[model samples]
Target chain A: MTRFFSLLILLAVSLPAHAAFNIFATVPEWGALAQEVGGDKVSVYTATHGLQDPHRIEAKPSLIARARTAQLVVATGADLEIGWLPLVVRESGNAAIQFGRPGYFEAARFVSMLEIPPVLDRTLGDVHAAGNPHIQTDPRNLLKVGEALARRMVELDPANATAYVANYQAFAERLRTALVRWEKQAAPLRGVPVLVQHKAFPYLQNWLGLKETGTLEPKPGLEPTSSWLAGIVAQQTAQPARMVLRAAYQHAAPSLWIAERTGIPVVVLPFTIGGTPEATNLFSLYDDTINRLLRAL
Target chain B: MRTTLTAALAAVLCFAPSADAANDAALAEIRAQVKQMKESYEQRIAALESRLADAEKTAAKAEATAVQVATAPPPAAPAAAMSAFNPEISVILQGQYKNMKDIPERGITGFWPANGHSHGDDHSAEQRGFSIDHSELVFTAGIDPYWRGNLTLGIQDNEVEVEEAWFQSLAIGHGLGLKGGRFRSGIGYLNDKHPHAWDFADAPLMYQVLFGSHASYTQDGAQLKWVAPSKLFVEIGLEAGRGSTYPGTDENANGANAGAAYVKFGGDVGVANSWLAGLSYLQTSAKDREAEFEDVNGLAAQGLFDGTTKTWIADFVWKWAPDGNPSDRNFKLQGEYFRRTEKGELDCLDEEGVGNACDPAMSGATVLSNYDTRQSGWYLQGVYQFTPNWRAGLRYDRLDSGRRDFGVNANNLLVADYRPQRATVMADYSWSEFARMRLQYAQDRSMQGVTDNQVTLQYIMSMGSHGAHKF
Candidate 1:
């Protein structure tokens, strides 16, 4: 028994060490961005999946354990995961990846935000109230986030800095080419008036030069009401909006109601990573949203 | 009709010409023209009056439309119908079953009849019972942008009681202002919140022995907590009454008196990650009667005798959540330890058996003793979250009564009634923020020959107020 124990111990010590930094991204979009920059030098995990609502996720113990071992942590801060993420990080006890530390990254820092609310109040149905947290819908914002991740990855793992910088340059050039193509395709869509289920596509609206006529929701965080729907219908009837747009995961009732009342085709756009089968990566998420808008218009 | 005739006469003069101008030769032509103009004016005035009447009618119609829209019934849609009755009420129900065996005479089982039989079969194994540990109804009202109130009533073991009734003033920037009756003391880790927040259904051995199962540490008090200039939280509280039958205690001893003054200081540190540490102190006198009884009947009446004593305690807590995020499935651990020393007298029996000799068979009389029993106890416990919903915990407790020689009496058969040592291991699965189930097995071995195996299964839920407080 003693000899067998010794042999087992020797086998454990003989295993090859994994030097790659372990990273935990708050959402899948950040996870894809980390993978783009880190390549094989980092292993990444995302707390929220494609189909889940990122705002209301319950903090489970498993997430804390993952954060404990992580050398780097990335999140969409602006209170996107405010309900649960802060408590998880506090419990993990890994000071290296804590907020403001070198290993901590907030993707919002890299992108210029839209819909930065001048006033914030919870009475408005849990508004992000700071700024729009859906900056990923803009291709320019995605490139900025990609570059920030690349810079942070190089800072944390200096040995792999060259590879990370090279990867980011290639990704940035490809994104620049895609941006030109998308702008050409979206040129005809400029100044188009549209209605959406939620304010999740402000960046996309800016990118395509679309005017957001209004939202179907009565308030930011609240569900739609009939009176609110009636008011929307009255407004839409007078102004005659072109299309009703909705995130794939948002409740379909309000969008369908607006579509029925206004005689406008409802366009279900993938707003984030894993929102649609084709929108698995950050680039595809914006591409799918633009294509859907073009097809609907 | 007469009013219309008068209004026509006025329109002819107002629109045609003045009376002096009408008599001139040009006015004579004007008079023929005036007669024609008067006739024309009458027709025009009649048309203008009709148009004015129609305008009044239209104005009334618009007012009626406004009222109709204002008082219109909501649209008959499925979603709208459900939204009208916003269900803001939430309930949390908890149940527990405890199976305990070989209970020691000084342990929790000693407070109640271990078995159904009061005197017979002292060695018989006790059967378990199902208890409604906590069934609570909570009502929360969002009065406005700056005010909210929460009232919670709990039913435990078929007894109804109020757990929390407080109104919060959230408008105070960075300051949490609250006022109400029956609030837990801001002392120990487990004292500030409900039992559902505990890893184990039963409190730690130290808490049970020191404060009993309910921990009458709550008082009718007023407290003000403010964020200091340095960002740490400083709370100061004063209570006018003593501990009561509920979870918190009245600071006063006898009637209404100045109970006690308590102050706590703590803060959260780290930009994203955070650590919380607190220090607290409480000083209160036990009821004069309780102290006098210990001196007279407990010590003097028996051969063992002593003077009166007082009670005081000091506590500290430190917790760190390194990542400062609650949703991440990562390594999270929290541990706390508390120590308390209580001073009091214990009465003993005389050598002649005059003091402790009740019925010789029923009462175990002892010989002379003269001393005060200074008792002390401490416990250490910790929990680590394996996932967001699952956690495991371990605890160890030891208590020592200062009266070591009191148990040495051959005639005193109640030697089993002394301080004991215990250890517990608990594992729980929290299914959601409001619901969880726990399974715990504890082993208790006393200084006497008794040993117990206790297994408890508890299901807990919470609603209405804010969720559990993190360490």
Candidate 2:
């Protein structure tokens, strides 16, 4: 029995040596990015899936359990996770991944934010004080955030610093090549007027130079009503948009309703990794996004 | 260069006199001009070459530093980048208009009064027509690297009360947490939650019978909780407190008067459903716990009991949302069951000595007897969110009076075999996350055979900080 116990202990200690670094990602995009940069040196646990709303997540016990064992916690800060992340971090009881620690990395801090409200008010409907946190929509932001994220990983796990750097460089090189190709393919989408279901695509619009004609939601985070849809339809009659864009997680009812009246196409974009079957990884996410938009055009 | 050429021109002009002299002077002037131009070009070339050398040196220095930065790891981010300790302050404004029967001495029938001896105006009493509920002021902030503190003050008309004040450990590793001070005990699912988070305007009958009407089982003490490192989501916690509330009286004695322990487990089922269940136990002691009761002759009297009480609670909750997006639609089902057992001694005193049924031999004297009783109750509630800003809920609760043995003091009090129950339904509409208005109706039969139909219109508005609720 003693030998058996020793054997079990040995197995437990030896198993984690290869993939010893544990990363707790608040969203699927960060988890996918971390895996791309960390390679096989880290094991990641994503707290929310692609279909789940990041802002409305509950601080479940399962998330706390995953956070307790994590060496690093990567999130899209800027109050994008203001509703749940604070509670989860506090309940985890893991000091290493607390705010301002080396193990805490926020992707939004490394990227240039957009849609900063001129005034701070809750009356604006859940407006983030730090601006829009959907930085992953633009592939170029990924390169910048990935570089900083790699440095954070190195600081937390210095033993594998070289590997982290090499991995980031490799990822940057691949993504840079893909960015050139995606830009060339999406050049025709430039200056094309489109409607959005939610205010979730500023970075995407900025990258592709797509003209945002209007939003289905009357305000940010508010559901679209029939009157709002009718207003969009009336506006489309004068300055007609070509297509309506919606995220994979959003309900397609409103976008489809607008499309039906205006005779415009409805394009669904994988807003993050694993949002669609083809968007299973970082590169495929943008590839699938551009392909859908091009098809719609 | 220009100056030198001008000097040569002036010398040539000064020497010119006759035609032959002029020709010779002009040729010499041309030759001197050419010589001056050659020296001027040499000086300009030297100056340009020196400037080019300086530019090259600076470029080399910049390139060398760039190389150094590229080879070395970047400096660590500042430790205080996100550690600005700004306290989260918030206030909750709540008011309601209630329409119900006028019953000043309202008490649950067939059960011991929960308000005990210190009762004046019950805190949960809803005056007819309109009244402002408690306005709550909350402050929470990280004290340092190791602790987080929270303070909440409840304000009513001309009165202020400290509802909760506690400090929780932040840096306690190993999935362990420690909390100290006056805070609500985590004995039942809804016990620790504030009133604003409740779906209905009123509490369940089970809770009202166990504690007091609309009262929470709070304690002033310390608690420790541990979470297991497992995929199934297991947690265990224990608390020790000075139970100076209902079901327990302040004895002013040393040591812990109340103790509680609980174990909880939860997990998600696929992508659309999640569940959590827990079992909790509480043990407390009471000295001279007082309650008003009626005798066989229907006269007013009081009963004081000294006893040890134990309670057990089991709770469960299940939530469902399509694709895990609750903004569109969601549903939650929650329920809790509790059983309590008490053993003690009861002293019955005749007030005003006007009751003839208080045992003629024991007139003007306290009737002492051995007392023991057992009681149980359960409640189930469900809340449905059909839209992003609207929710409706229904709750049903029932309590069993169980059995009571009063020994020799049985004739001094009235004991009946009765079960009290209530059914409530409410709907609330939210303008946003910070504001909500609700309308509720309830059929309450908790007061013996008297059924009171109640309706309430309520509004709750939060200002400043946004709080994330726990599941």
Candidate 3:
């Protein structure tokens, strides 16, 4: 009996320590960003991946199970994930990551907005009524996300506050220098008329001084109709566009059709971190996007 | 062409001179006029170029500003994680496959006759088909800090239906506030929430018989629930909708006038562990108008004159764990007992296979009678996590049906029918938080000479923007 008790004690001692923090992120972009800030101090999981369309994700029992264990959660707010993420959180009953908790992080909190529709309606095809949720396309917003993430990490683990601040500073400096070079390289694209697959490139176009001649999607989130494509083709023929921009994850068929009809080069841009194999981190996402657009032009 | 020729002629005349002195004076005037025209043209071109340059610069600045602003931190927190006013939508797809053997020839009858048959016979490959068991898309939005609403649309077996749609106010402190729509009645344990929470993918025998194939426990109604200062909870609801038909008689054979009202009360007890017990009462009026049918020549008069039936259900759930850790081993025991009785007039026949002599005025007369049915079942479930990524569960359920009058009798006669008991066992292995593979076997010994068995294997996977798990 004494030996049995000793064995039990040994087994209990041998077990691994429980994870310190349980972090849930809405998408891979937030997951990767959280990892950069949390390092080994936290365990993070992403609800969506780069290969899938963010707008059409399906909820499953497994996702609910993950949410049940999270202590901290990060998500892209506005109406981007309004289609799915809230149900999982409420069902999970994770009080720590519930609304108003310190562990909850909304990445959109730090970014300024653009193209906010004065009037909103569902007839225009699943618009984010609050504006666009694709804020990660711009590099400067990422800098702000990094800073906000650092603050949250510090609050969660105050002992590592100095390290978090230092890391954030280093990341911001490197990003700022890179942005200057990217802006210079992309300067020649000023005033160039372009077509886009979705509203995902407003920030990019803003940065490069490019004109958005039109979008392939007749309306936001709506599939293109044959008539709409024909009209676009006719318009582009009469007044040519220099380039057509498409996200790496978008269906290539429509963009391909537009390119084939207009004789314009189609450039696939990485819309988020790790959106493409070459774009692994935040800085690399911008690098790959600017280089790809410049090459195509 | 004429205008150009006249202008050229006029210019030559203006430059021509008659004498040397006159020519010099005219030439000076011509030179002065030419220089002034040249200066004016130069000024206009410079002004236009400056305007163009300014426009380009402004556009560049605007573009730069947009980028800077986009990258900047938002003035307010994102509504996705913390805002109570935003709505969240979710879609789920689930499929299952089951193999049945030795199914009865009479088919498995239930509340609804259309769902009673197994689609195959005993000798054949019994049951083989894929079912989209749960194709649900749910939308939920928080109205404020203390109020929320939920709407769920589901499709199963090619039929579209509404599963649960209601609004709840959390600001009522210990009190619950609700309004509008149909939701699960707080009668039994399994009737109140999603079927995924059950140990097995399918519902228990008691649940199927009492509520029908998809369950009719939810109806268009309103309810108010309150949690007492003690651990007790009380709920009262009134509903108007279709009712379940089972045990050979369509409880609500008529189409429109079937409605019910119910009240339930339960409470939690125990110190270290926890246990809950609840009792519910329901009264519904039958909708069938064929209660007076008579076949004296065939001796098959099984009609009942009673239109109202009263049902009572008692249920309890007990949970135990040494450390109260879900990841570790734990035990749960749950059960429910239901008794239903109706007062009506039933046909009476003599033992000589002949109808008793009766006056014309007495034919199909109403008589006081009683129809009683009882059903009870329970399950003991346990879960043990051998590792973080692997866990195992075991569950067993048994159901017994008391004697009851069925529409048809043995040998195509008319009398009471006896349904035997049933038992089921399930074993499941969860591979990860997002994936699980389960195997279940169930047996039905309801008929004396007929016995049936079913084996099912199921796998589930999920993808997309899911929230975090609660501890």
Among all windows of 10 consecutive residues in model 1 chain B, the one with the lowest summed lDDT is B109-118
How well is each residue in B295-342 modelled by candidate 3, as lDDT tens digits?
A: 433442333333555666776666553322222344556676676655
Residue A287 miss distance in model 1 (angstroms): 13
lDDT of 2 by residue, A43-136 (tens): 9999888787777888777777788788899999988888888887877766778887787899988777788777877777778877888878
Best by TM-score: 2
lDDT of 1 at A239: 80
Off by over 4 Å in 2: A1-19, B1-85, B118-125, B356-364
- Between candidates 1 and 2, the one scoring higher on DockQ is 2
Residues B1-471 of candidate 2 have per-residue lDDT tens digits of: 212222322332243334676588788998999899767655654454454345436534543443221121232243375544568889999888899988877777777888765545636445778888889999998888888899999998789899999999887555666788999898888888888888888777778778885558888887766666567777766677888888888878766787777778888898888888999888888898988878877877788899988889999999999987777789999999999988999988876566635544546878889989899999999999998889999999899989888888787678867889999999999877789999999998888878999999999999878568888
Give the whole-model CA lDDT for all candidates, comma-separated: 0.57, 0.80, 0.57
Question: Cα miss at B245, model 1 (Å)?
Answer: 4.3
For candidate 3, give the docking quality class from DockQ. Answer: incorrect
DockQ of candidate 2 compared with the true complex: 0.22
State which docking tier applies to candidate 1: incorrect
> Per DockQ, what order, best first?
2, 3, 1
Q: What is the TM-score of each candidate against the true structure?
A: 0.47, 0.85, 0.51
A3-95, model 1: which lDDT tens digit per residue? 332233233223343366889999888898888888888889787666555765544444655665577889988778776676556445445
By DockQ, the best candidate is 2
What TM-score against the true chain A does chain A of each candidate get?
0.91, 0.93, 0.89
